[model samples]
Target: MRKFPFLLTVATIPAAIPAAATAQPVQSLDQVEETVLADDADDADDADATGEVEAITVTATGLFTRIENTGQAVTVIGRDEIEAVQGADITRVLARAPGVAFSRNGPPGAFTGVRVRGGEAEQLLVLIDGVRVADPASPSGGFDFGTLTTGTVGKIDLLRGSNSTIWGSDAIAGVLDISTRGRSGLAGSVEYGARDTLFASATGGLSEDAYFAGLAASFFRTDGFSSAAAGTEADGSEQFTLGGSVFVDLTDQLELFANTRYANSDIDIDGFPAPSYTLGDTSETQETEQLSGALGLAYYGQDLTLRASYALADTARDNFDPALGAAPLFTSDGNSQNLSLRGEYRLIGGLTLAFGGNREWSEYQTDSDTGEDATITGAYVQAGWVLGGLAAHVGARVDDHDRFGSATSFGGDVSYRVGGGWRLRASVGEGFKAPTLYQLYSPYGNLDLQPEQSTSADFGVEHGVRGSDFHAALTLFRRDSENLIGFDNATFTYANIARARAQGIEAELGVDLAPSLRLAGVYSLVDTENRETDNELARRPRHSATLFADWQTPLGLVIGGDLRLVGDSFDNAANTVRLEGYEVFDLRASYPFGDGVELFGRVENVFDEEYQTAAGYGSPGRGAFLGVRAQM
Candidate 1:
């Protein structure tokens, strides 16, 4: 027998002003310079209002196409939007996106988890400069948002829903594609804040007719508050990051490029007894290092393009206990390598075809667990068509894994404009996640576990007021997952014995009231349940919403505020431990000085509302920061 649970419907008023345009002038997030022959020139004038732009997106289909023309639910966050939020970490910035839910154990450097549409953290795929960077050694094979900062990032594109047919592997939920800064210029910033926190960064780049190079580096340190509730001892953290990119134009049609990023951090933490909420006296230290690099070449023809790339990611972590002497308690190392070839050709009329193949190899080793390795090879092909106000896409992929044998996935979507600023779209996709190396080879592993599989669908409608600054969208989505891997209490081993269903509605609105004032809002209502026990998924909020506003004054001053709300959720799978939800308010202001200089300040948790994303963990209270920035 199967059961479908329904959730209460909540009414929310739409607020206006696109969050992406709050920091700068009003512009469509999807707008891109049309360089391809298939671009629609007639609709260029209405791009801003309709959320349609000429920008090219590679993640949607492994080929460059207009973001508005792609039949997928997507959002783009550019540099301006990033700076406008003025967040110290990537998790804070990402939380502003619709349908995104995140939880952190404690402060900025603590372990963090992100999920989309009630999916597990590991189900989402993360790419930095086209290189996969998830830590295979981690229990969930997921990327830690705590280690990432936005100082070197130029743009981010988030594609929601099952996209494994194009991204493969862990893309059972969605894909987060990040691009580093590659333009010419020099920029830097210095900041000081509460808790004796200090941050500084420098970035420089050069772009010539045929050659370009860019570099960025940053340092951060803070004497943070306690990680555990009712604890007096304070934990601290420090991190250093460096990134660089280089591009060479070998010929009019051929180019070569490379990108590299490295991050290192040291953090202090508190310990807790098993199954208890009380904080223990044991103090611990953690050291982490991450590196990612990619090198690629591309040959561009009149109507055809070909590309080849190689990428690598490595991560290591060591934990130590001062009370137990100098010997490390545990250590882990993980690495991944990928080689890919892809091409795109323009067909007759407004049709395009894209195909790609990839080979992936990964390994994980831990001091307490035996090491493991695995390899996978995959190939995919997709077709896209765009004519006037109508767009369509279809793609399929097959992966051959050393342990799981083979699996195939497919997806398709269609979008159409119905005139008078209305657009309708729908999509259905299939995705799969292979068992991680740890889940397959560890002492508690299960060799006979089957890979997790899912089917997801979404229907949406959008309206943009012509000749005005108002845009809104409503989306309905559902996902069904089977063969979910979980620990078996009786056997003390992992097994694929659970199933889940998630359904939700997402609403968003943006409006610019005047040239200097803007407002944006997002709301999501989700209902997720585990089929085996007929209970709600742990730590997933049923309701979440955000409201943001920005104002630019005549005196060259900019002010912004954000209000965020999260509903209650359970902390345990049995739905026995309830966690209370909370709301937080934040404010920021910036003043421009002469000669490319500016002064900025921010206040976080303005009301000092005490809250926790994890039970027994302490979330930050009211805090303030001041900074200066300069660019050329």
Candidate 2:
């Protein structure tokens, strides 16, 4: 489960920045270059705090590596680890990453889903700014992250495996690129907590030479948590958002950009715990709205940098009331539009070349008894290479679906440095996913479903340590999937006899030990199978790990702790109930009084660990929260 909405998209080059760099500042969501440059492109050392992480301009990978040379397995969660972990959502920040596995149907924005390495979840491929929003009409095509809301995020990049060449189709178990935050100056913040939590946001920026603008807004609410069955509690939501961006400076070459967004969410679905929470019929009331827009144009001479973009998204869902009496009361709508063109060239010395093409159109509608309607189109191309430190990449794609007739894929990756800071990587990929529209015309579904394919490979190694400023990485992965469509409990629909195979390994480490004391950890191991009903693929858990430590003492306070563990899987998949494995603990502390206001507190699942990765659902046990943030 990955949900990012923090904002970022900076395009700079005019006047080469005040003299020779040194004007690119403005990053402090707790550094690390906002978690490894939008989902694993790695390496961007400290940079003395801010200046916007030295001109940060990562819209999520395009065959670029710096996180010590991107050796695959990536993870980055900033904003001070999401404000010292307290009711931290986004699947608890990807459970502190590593192999990754998430599932939640309740508590803090329920109905969440994520699975990597062990694949599943529409074989992963999520992006917000660089396009691709999944759910072309979920029949298992993925993208739900519980309807997203990380409170106008500012950072989150988790890239684990696969990556269909240069992003095309569901990247088969990998690819999560979400970037936001590029409206220049004017900061803002506000907060309130505990069950009825509240949040506020603001951003600003404006440049001249032709024109540049930026703006952002946010509002949120929650009234949930506390329910162990019986009458039920946890079920409340509210949200509102606005975004903007405009750029035009067609001089030295040519440049133009525009973007807009609006979002709304209001949900009150006290619907859970079947067998009658208050009276069997699960309550429901929802309203979901979204409007998206984008336009782009870029052209730079000398070394080349050509671009074009067009994007549009419209989504709506309204269901005033429904308690499952007759089990039907609906309204659904979806729309998607995209067009792309890109070119980047610098072939001579260091080498750099890129290409792009994309086209998409989608639609969905509903009246009641479950509805359907469809259309789709696609195209792709990509390439990259560099000298000196050595790097290489390739891509390919083809998609045409009226009912799942066309599909094609290609992949590649390579990196090397092998010197002191170390670096070595290898990646192979192939991805494809089509056949949605509720699995081709839902009537009882199954219009001879098909289209679900994947192939993957990974190899990694990374290291950095010069006089004690540590960093590390290690990864190994494999995946194979085919067809995969489920339904066989009398729901009457489809069956492709399923097929899955997964293998995984991920490890990470971090350290700073001095300045104020810091340490980090992540680990994961998995093995999943389903070779056609042989069992073992459900909630997937073979092992998981996460550890953390932070300290900064000299009065101003700032302490932390974090730990997580998971093991034991199989909630269903004919494996006959077997979900046990858990370990959670979190703690935080903050104290500052130099104005800008800051008094934080947190304690989550401290020692209270019940277990269940979704067998009967129902999570959030042992909790605590406290908050305060103001910068006026």
Report the C-alpha lDDT of model 1 over 73-144, residue by residue, as the tens digit.
776677777777775678667767778888877778878888888898889888887789899998778998
lDDT of residue 528 for candidate 2: 89
User: RMSD to native for every prediction?
Assistant: 8.4, 23.2
Q: For each candidate, what TM-score against the reference?
A: 0.91, 0.31
lDDT of each: 0.77, 0.63
174-214, model 2: which lDDT tens digit per residue? 87765444445565555566666776666667665456677
Output the lDDT of residue 499, model 2: 78
For each of the candidates, give the backbone clash count. Answer: 6, 18
How far out, in Å, is residue 9 in model 2? 36
Candidate 1, residue 334: Cα displacement in angstroms equals 0.7
Alpha-carbon runs more than 4 Å astray in model 2 = 1-73, 76-84, 91-140, 147-169, 172-193, 196-327, 331-417, 426-428, 442-469, 472-516, 519-549, 552-587, 590-600, 603-632
Weakest 10 consecutive residues of candidate 2 by summed lDDT = 13-22
TM-score of 2: 0.31
Q: How far does residue 425 in candidate 2 sit from its true spot (Å)?
A: 3.3
